[model samples]
Target chain A: MGQVLAPGVTAPDFTLHVTPDQTLSLSDLRGRPAILAFYPADWSPVCGDQMAVYNQVLPEFREHDAEVVGISVDSAWCHQAFAETRHLHFPLLADFEPKGAIARQYGAYRDGEGVCERALFVVDRDGIIFWSYRSPIAVNPGADGILDALDRLEKQENSDGRAQSAGNGG
Target chain B: MAELKVPVTAADHARGGANGQVVLVEYGDYECPYCRLAHVQVMQLGRHFGDDLTYVFRHFPLTEIHPFAEPAAEAAEFAGAQGRFWDMHDAIYAHQEQLSLLFLMGAARALGLSERTLEVALEAHTYAPKVAQDFRGGIRSGVNGTPTFFINGHRHDGPFDYQHLADAIQSVRSGL
Candidate 1:
């Protein structure tokens, strides 16, 4: 839970009701890599900018075969409004009632602020966590930062898979 | 030979004392909206209680996120030094978004301070240490983020409305 979602640990899956999109569960996204961008609140200036950045760079995410999703403690209604206002192409999942229950499960909840800090998680095709970064509540861990890390994980995994195949052939 | 261990004094902190009453200690950044929201409640509580409660504002700037927060906090402290702390505090909250030196100086002018003097104070980096001290104090007291408050030393662990905060303060008063 402390900074290492490690390479092999299976991600804990939950079905969160998202908006302007549909409900999503980690299990439903199996057989494909995905990125979860956990932000503090929707409609917040910084958060709006973060999602907009993701929308602009969505093509880059598609090239990596990854679906990017944003989660927050805001209600579905708020997410809908925020998505419409910001023109975000990605789904913004509502984690409102429990107030950071999932964020705490992911070790992104900050005790002091009573809100989920900004965090990013990359899950592999096998549903194992590949990369993660959680910024302190106030600062944003920009989408580009996550993309860079995701790129690294993808390259590393591909090279390892190729090496394993060569060994098997040998 | 004995190692000298100095005890921290209450005078060292404007908020700490054994009043046995619930004191709402708010560790906030000037630029934080949540802090601004909670500040309004703090002011309201003053009207509701009428001298029965104390609210202490501690500075904890998330400098990495809000680049101007620390500077704003320092300016507030400089204003506080001239007995205009609360006025400047309110002004900052009132003008949270446009947190520029020029805006702060305008606040100083509105508060009847010499603009030149306040500008020099801001440029001197005068109150940064005090604001930084508040952040260190918050960390030592288990504050990991902004808008953290302690109701009679028990942390307010969730989003709170005015009623909830009033109730907590009442509980502390009864216990005292």
Candidate 2:
């Protein structure tokens, strides 16, 4: 297992291919919360189930103004096939050129495994990581943690805004 | 570390005693081979524990991989409408190798369900929302894969072999 990026640190920004002709940049989605799910590979048993679960709960994620993206060492072509087969609505970013480069920036890359560990990072609207978790290689590490973190972030933002307005009045 | 967020309720399709000492909940997909294997073990556990265990089954179909899963879950739910959910569930798993729409219709016929009603239900997806509800409930309960089990509301991270599960249940009973 790999160490997760600590909360409160600015998330490393990267642009990765989503399809043969499309790409997604981490920084571009900064105004809204983002969830980065790093997995070992495409088509594997555990990875397929994990991603499918996320696909099912997309509405819950969107309720908190969060966009979910999956990253792996697979190529764009591979991702396209997998996404089509699974009917996955989220973009699957390919870290294929350097193989696990984006995963490494998030501390999710494994040195000798040639793949990324099953990791999750929740970045707040400000691009700072609000929570992170590294699950056991075979476990799916369900979405509860991500939802809890997003809920906390929403509460934090509301409180911060209230304090700011109160200070101004004073 | 995942715990069952939603406890088994009156709305759930369950077997065994309602006030049993141990409640075993399985989030399963009808089309997954591993879930088939776990199905046998679950049956064994039920027989071994008898009245002491209350077993609940929930839908967690990996519809992308197991193409027949979602429809199969709906078939079971449709049967639930007739108060024969367990019969449909057992038939589906028992005939796991033949999970086609035709086979599902035949299973419903064998279980004394109206074939026309089942066909209409399947075509119109009458029970799809119910299955979707179960899937969402499974996600909320931290289910990431098929055949995931929760013994007394705590996620069972161990293997689903008979002895492992039986021992876990025993330990939980002793703790209580």
Candidate 3:
């Protein structure tokens, strides 16, 4: 089994069908850092609340020049329903048919049950995973965590330095 | 934006099995100790209720912290392919710490899957997509955490041990 992709590893590029549109791809966000928040399911209490937190912090994400993308094993139709219900501003990709392929590739899919774990990966413009975190199924990670990582990434970018010593993860 | 009742695919029907009056859907994370504890309770419920109950397992593995969870899930899928899903499920919970690659292969071996075959199946990721599909289904149903159970499509509002599940099952079955 492929291990979880770690910091500085090249993120596997993908083009999943997302709600509000299906033409989006990770590459589309080139020249900017991106936040890939992979949650287990939609409409669940903690996941729903987490999305709302991300939505509330949209301004911070924009300020950091990082496009936020949420992913799940849900179908496009399901993604649409979830995005609408939560009023999410970002694209929620549906990895429906194959289930957790994207999540598995990113090393986030749990094997015992067929679902993506609550995982986060922050990738730089070149698709390098700069920071990563995975909250337990019982814990809902907040936007503050992502924002903190973004802040560190920005510092590294501003300094034009390697993330190794800069501490990309919070 | 409305949640649609998509028709069940052949795979879904096959995996969901024959349902009784009470269908229990559990959204769980393999790495979670709590979920593992819940796993025992779920099995107990299944045993106690027998023909009147059905259990559906869904994944919600937390990737960051638990490094071995995703692979453990893959192992379960490997067993599922050979028609030993429940056996594999119990094995995983019983040996959560031993779910690393080496240990998973050992578990498969104990379950009678040949080592070579287990290696090939796990490497091929034969059941990876199916695992993800379960996660998507849970998400569609609005599940965010592990061990979140529902009875007969109605969310069960408790810790979900034998008594709670038994009562819920009886309520649903009696009504039916």
Candidate 4:
């Protein structure tokens, strides 16, 4: 229910902790399409269900050459516990140092609530935001939209490649 | 808002007429308690609608929470291989609380399935890919939770209680 970071903009880049010792930057994931799942908090009911659904569909995401990363205001320690408890295979980056700094960059931070809104962003291989959605905090917004965007991205890339080949021949 | 991305095909485990007036597709997890409750409602719906409704069940196992979910789904798929998918499906929900490897084998036995065959299938994970396929289809169809239903290719966004689902079916039927 908030203004999402619109498509076609260069997605704001950030580095965040995935584990106590490991950190990942958005720029590092630019060569492949990536899905950023911004959620309110770790260990909440809807958040748990949302992440679990993504975990189950990781293979499908991979087929489209996409990698998923969950971002939240929770600390790295909290994320580690929740990720382990849920058996999440994807990295859950903590936006905790400045507390919602990365989320604020994407307009996903709920200022007064002290949490991030439930949102999703699909960043293309070139780091441009391809699609984004802000869902109600209580709803587990399913993976359909992300997959649709990825499908479109794949088709567009195919056409672009064909056009480039035609240009070369000309 | 969500539509069924993949149409039901011969590979799906379905009941009732192939050309039935209404099709009800459920994305269910065998280990989910809500899915167990919905199972009874689904059965009632089948009885109430009879030949007018085609019921299809697909796997959406929350394996992280319910460790046995994937295995239970695999058991059902193995039963499907022997042409007893519904029987295994029914047995699993009926004995929902007793979902263990041994219990699944017992259910297979009760359905007159070869216990040896099921054992081999489970150990070999012969049906895991089929369960994974169902899960992927459910994700593509916008299934966010257990017991998600789609009637006539549209996601049922309301509660899945008997009354609500019955009315939903009626509405779709009347539209047709």
Leading candidate by lDDT: 4
Lowest summed lDDT across 10 adjacent residues in model 2 chain B is found at B132-141
Those runs of model 3 whose alpha carbons end farther than 4 Å from true positions after fitting are A1-170, B1-17
How far residue B174's Cα lies from its native spot in candidate 1, in Å, is 2.2
How does model 1 do on interface RMSD, in angstroms? 11.5
Candidate 1 lDDT by residue in tens digits, A53-139? 566556668877788989888888898988777667778888776787787778777667676678889998778888887766655
TM-score of each predicted structure versus truth: 0.50, 0.88, 0.50, 0.87
lDDT rank, highest first?
4, 2, 3, 1
Which whole-number lDDT from 0 to 100 does residue B81 have in model 2? 90
Q: Write the per-residue lDDT of candidate 3 for residues B1-176, one digit (tens) a residue.
A: 11212223335412223655567777677777878888887767767777667667766554444567777787777787788777877888988866678987888888898778878877887777877776545544544345666676655655566687778778888898
Question: lDDT score, residue A115, model 1?
Answer: 65
Candidate 1 segments exceeding 4 Å error: A1-170, B1-20
**Global lDDT of each model?**
0.71, 0.89, 0.73, 0.90
Clashing pairs in 2: none
Q: Report the alpha-carbon TM-score of model 3 versus the true structure.
A: 0.50
Provide DockQ values for all models, in the order shown.
0.03, 0.52, 0.04, 0.62
Query: Which residue ranges in model 4 land beyond 4 Å of their true spot?
Result: A162-170, B16-20, B47-51
For each candidate, what is chain B's TM-score? Answer: 0.85, 0.97, 0.83, 0.97
Candidate 1 TM-score over all chains jointly: 0.50
How high is the DockQ of candidate 2?
0.52
